[model samples]
Target chain A: MDLLSNLSLGFATAASPENLLFCLIGVILGTLIGVLPGIGATATIAMLLPITFQLEPVSSLIMLAGIYYGAQYGGSTTAILINMPGESSSAVTAIDGYQMARRGKAGTALAVAALGSFFAGTVATLLVALFAPPLTAIALKFGAAEYFSLMLLGLVSAIALAHGSILKALAMVVLGLILGLVGTDIYTGAPRFTFGITEYADGLSFVALAVGIFGIAEILRNLEGDQDRTVLGTSLGGLLPSRADLKRMVAPMLRGTAVGSILGILPGGGAVLAAFASYTIEKRLSDHPEEFGQGAIAGVAGPESANNAGAQTSFIPLLTLGIPANPVMALMVGAMIIQGIVPGPNVASEQPELFWGIIASMWIGNLMLVVLNLPLIGLWVKLLKVPYHVLFPVIMAFCSIGVYSVNSNVFDLYAVAFFGLMGYVLLKLRCEPAPLLLGFVLGPMLEENLRRAMILGRGDPTIFVARPISLTLLLLTLAVLVVMFLPSIRKKREEVFVEAD
Target chain B: MKNITVDWTDAMAGLIFILFGLLFGVQSLGLEIGTAFRMGPGYFPLVLSGILLVLGGLIVFSAIHDRGGEGVGKMAWRGLFFILPAPIFFGLTVRGLGFVPAIFLTTLVAALASFKMRPLWALVLAGAVTVFATLVFSYGLGLPFRRFGPWLEF
Candidate 1:
């Protein structure tokens, strides 16, 4: 009941001309970057974060959130138009969506994707409205030990999700944890790893790390191929799906939304998991299973809807519990902190306008994406025809400038280049960067909580299990690890790990 | 064949972790901070290093015993050449020329590393990149930029 009233206040705030304008701009920019291969919403938001330093908190968050879900919608566009997935979440869409495009049903595929995403976004936003308060209340009961255990579970989950060798993934996680320890210790006045550099005193910049790892690295990886080109074809048909097509899509969309909403709440499994899980479910439930990889409309609709829904709802963990479920959410948390808003259980009560306004703006942004993307479909398709010779240099230059502008420091430019090289090496070695990023973002928070919990318990490790929520999470982590190591489950786990790409 | 890649990667990572652990352990010798609490400034890192050492040793043992796959070679050189040099080039260029020039040079070097274009095409590509960057970062946003000459001043 309070949510409805709060939502009304949010509407009033979001309806303002300034917020709406920024939201529109965010969606447009987000879509453009999402349509471009190798640049994801996470990197785009990281690059754009510094610009929002001057904006009001609500407006800044609205815009950042818009970029997040907008990228989700836009990723589907590229996945369908070409075999290339613009984001990891869109990889599932590309499997079936590209097939549909090849079969000359590109228009139908795009239309279904857009509509399904719109529907899922609306539903997910409602779920966030309804479930967030209760979740926050539940989270409020968690002690330091519980928080530490939850983060431990999150780290374990990230390691499990990572592709390639588990040892490499754990190594990256350890490296991330070490990097997170670079800044001044919160409890102690002493510096840990500043190395006497003033910039290092504040610890490693999130923007620098994200842009370097995801953005610049992606550019390097794309460039490694001698002919990095996207497939393009000339075909224009009706942009709207028929009544029959809508009927066919309804069940999958609902199922996808359900899957997405549930998985989106889980730390370390956001839109990417949602999309993959949705596609798998759709395939399992399909009447014509063979048509799945051959451009089935349901294949695109289900996963696209799930991906967008998951992207929107993934904000729940960050907003309610101050736990970022993914890198994008971590960046959103950075944005919130930049705006001077402490993200936690009291956020809604403390800043109703900012909270509700951001939620309301998500719906507006989704509406804008649908309205804006339909016309821009043709434009993006045309852009896809641009030769790699012209496109890649522009992308690399933009990435360098974006990385440099954060502090107006040339050191960050070097950092971006350095991490870009590391990213490429990681790709060659089949190491997944997503888990590394998750570790980096979560590492400090995890360590802080772990230390605090131990201090409170006078160095007793049993405190982690003595607390109810902490015990549950620790047990869950143990269960997941045990299951993953089981012979039968281990085989399936390997398949899932490889299937992520 | 199934375990060869995993075994090698594990052993390498384990060795690196152990080295880091020993280094940190050595460094902690000079610290005078009291360890009354579970987490002194040195406490977490020390514990982490120890854990890393243990994990690393376990991985090396696992790799040695791994019989599921054939051993592969050390690493791929083409990947090394393409991926490792961009950062070194960026470090070399950044201080003297400032952010913009450093970016231009980095992109140019990266393009060369890509090895997808001829020398003439690479120069053209670099020039085009510089122009595009100037338009976006300098002209469009009006960010401060250093020019090559006083004659170009507005």
Candidate 2:
């Protein structure tokens, strides 16, 4: 009954006319960019973060939540049609979905992906409503030691999940933590790394870093290819799946949702990891195992459902602990801070409407995607034909205006350029940017907690091991590092990443 | 000397991290490095810089000896030439030239990154972006940007 009432309040908040309009705009815009190659949800939201500052806290957050999941929906469409996933989470979907498109079953593949995502989204929303309250209660009891250890675990897990050499990923995370400490120190008011620039006293613009790393770096990578994408030019035959196809999909969707809900809760893993895990499981379980790479219906359905569920449930950590599980969640933390609402457990109690509104908006946004996108498939396909040269310039122009409008500071624009170059260089070295962003967001909080805990314990240094929760988290962090370095697991990890790539 | 293999990509990446580590480490040492109970601003960063330096060294050591040398691909030379400067140009000129001209020029510079783009198409794209950005950001949202700056005065 308590859960019922909470959800009702959430629905009431999300269903209002103005909120509905903003949610709709967010989903549409999210899809539009998600359907484009080389622009991920992280960059699109980063570019749009400045615009949302003008809106209400609840509305801005609702729209942002909508963009995050809406991109998941649109990502599958490109995976099926062009053999190029517009978002990385949908990468595995391209394996089978594109094959289906090539065989003139594009419509069936798209429909299956949409329906599976809708079902998973529905289940994940309920799970979030059910689990978030208890998690928040648990998080509220945490102290500085527990918090510090938890963030360390998160950073280490992030490095574990990243592609290529774990050493490089660890290096990126430390670099981000250092970069994050660039502004004035909170305890002493002394500038750490501002290099005598007054404009940077408030710290480097998060929007600039995100847009530069994900946005501009991506553009340069795309430019290296300069090759045109081969869009499936055949007219889609039927949007409905056959009865046999439906029967094959039901079990995978269920299993995928289950796998996704669990993995999505862990720090540093989300939709991409969930989808890959789901696909691998489905492939193993299939009676016709060889059909996986050649376009099995389950291959498309399972990962699509898993990724959508993972995308929705990833919000659990953000809403409950105020800690971001991924880069997109990091941006949410940034948004919350900018709106003068500190992220974490208190948000659920102090601002019930804002908290629940985002929860309810996830389902509503998913429903809109299913209803709106299937019919608008033609338009997205047409958009795939637009020249790349025209698109990047427009995106660049918007990135400039958006970064400048945040504080009306021209210096942020320059920061965008500097970070953009750095991002490109990092990308050249095959480094993943996701962990770096997560580290940047968690850095200040990590330092604050470490200092506070040390002070609280009178510099004993054993307090981290003395406390049960902190010890457990530190143990988990150590376990992850040990596993990453194990030769067998390292080989397996490289194989999985190679297949995904 | 028969098999002196070094993954250049990993080596370069390691060197970049080392440079950043040394930069932050030396700077943090300049600030106060107090004790644990009552820490200074530099204490945390200084420790992190040390960790980073150690990590960088490990990466370089691994890079020098690794056999699976996945060579780095072609660099985006043309993109780097044009795209990196677009925002810098916008930042420098937005105050003096006003929002309209600044945005137009910025977009124009970005378009030049692609060899496939023609001059007339780039001009038309710039004009469209200027008008649209002006309407939406300036007129619609009512952001406080001057239509024309003082430098534009005759």
RMSD of 1: 3.6
lDDT score at residue A373, model 1, on the 0-100 scale: 87
Q: What is the C-alpha local distance difference test score of each model?
A: 0.74, 0.90
* Residue B108, candidate 1: alpha-carbon lDDT: 68
Report the alpha-carbon TM-score of model 2 versus the true structure: 0.98
Cα lDDT over the full model 1: 0.74
Clashing pairs in 1: B1-B69
Compose the digit string of candidate 2's lDDT tens values, residues B1-154.
5576898889889999999999999999999988998899999999999999999898888888737578789889999999999999999999999999999999999999999999999999999999999999999999998878878999
Flag regions of model 2 displaced more than 4 Å. Answer: B66-68
**What local lDDT score does residue B143 receive in model 2, on the 0 to 100 scale?**
90
* Clashing residue pairs for model 2: none
